[model samples]
Target: MSEQSLFERIGGREAVEAVVGSFYEAVAGEMSLRVLYPEDLTPSREKLEYFFEQWLGGEPRYSERYGHPRLRRRHFPFVIAEHHAQLWLKHMRSALELQQIEREDFDSIWGRLESLANHMVNAHEEVPREPLPEDAWLT
Candidate 1:
């Protein structure tokens, strides 16, 4: 029998969207990683969910809309360092675990995300930027 595609093993578009939603929820809650997201996660979540859905083999919507991911180019403006990459992977790992996705599928997804995160690093030192106030709900 042919091996199942990662998308098939993970339950396709619906499942991937659920996982993305959960992962973003964790990101929205974290202090350090929160800044990577916009003030609202709705748009970001939609983009990622669609991206993964196409990437994992569900549909071509992402590429059709965005015309090549160009993940690094899109993320070049962000200051992702080793620590941030680790934290981002940590949350994603947790979300996959919580979804009860198979280990192999999880590893595959993590490996891609880790690679993308590593490539997203644009600066060695953190750039000076205004800090979010304690009461700020959005990063």
Candidate 2:
């Protein structure tokens, strides 16, 4: 239900953070998505952790600290394409699967993640830029 908080459904901040950390770990090693993350994912992880905390219906820390998510605006500088989206989703799915979250809960979380990933795309060009090798692998 929309009224229910994400923290409650996902097992609170600790659980969400664990899932995110797992996802990032996979992302860091993934050649296609390694560059998507910054040199340090600590802040990024914290932000998402807080955002999801509010998004699932708990507190509104994300909006309170950052104002409108403006996700697209924030990701405009990145060269996200179909390949990148697919790869990112792969890692996320893997992480969720590893977490062994309930099927229904996994679906809900994956649906939102899919929408957000799709929304982050900024380029449709045939020849998209490549991520730096060092940056491409999160590891």
Candidate 3:
């Protein structure tokens, strides 16, 4: 028989769902990261569940529903700098650890996540420009 996919080995849909839920819970406490997420997390949770299912070698439901994930493009509207990526990874790591998964499986999954998160950085820190003084306006 063919070997089961990582998704299956990791306990399939239920596990992925649990991980997504826990991950969001962790993100809630990250003040800087919170601005990147929507006020209502339901949509975020659903998209993540579907994306992980497809990415982990299960059915391609995410693609079917949303077309190509185009993850980086989708994230472009947000300012995902290195600091944001690190915060994201931090929460994700905590969530994954809570699962008590096998070490090998954890390493494999974390590696992929790290690569993806690193690729998501699209901006860098810069000082905010001060508003022009009212008197500077042309009469």
Winning candidate number (lDDT): 3
lDDT of each: 0.76, 0.73, 0.82
lDDT by residue (1-139, candidate 3, tens digit) is 9999989988899999999999998888788998888798887888899899999999987888777777776666677889999989998898878786888988999999999999888786342334323122211
Better of 1 and 3 by TM-score: 3
Q: How accurate is candidate 1 locally (lDDT)?
A: 0.76
Candidate 2: which stretches are off by over 4 Å?
A: 1-4, 125-139
Q: Comparing candidate 2 with candidate 3, which one achieves the higher TM-score?
A: 3
In candidate 3, residue 45 scores what lDDT?
A: 88
**Candidate No. with top TM-score:** 3
Candidate 2, position 66, lDDT: 74
| CA shift of 51, model 3, Å | 0.4
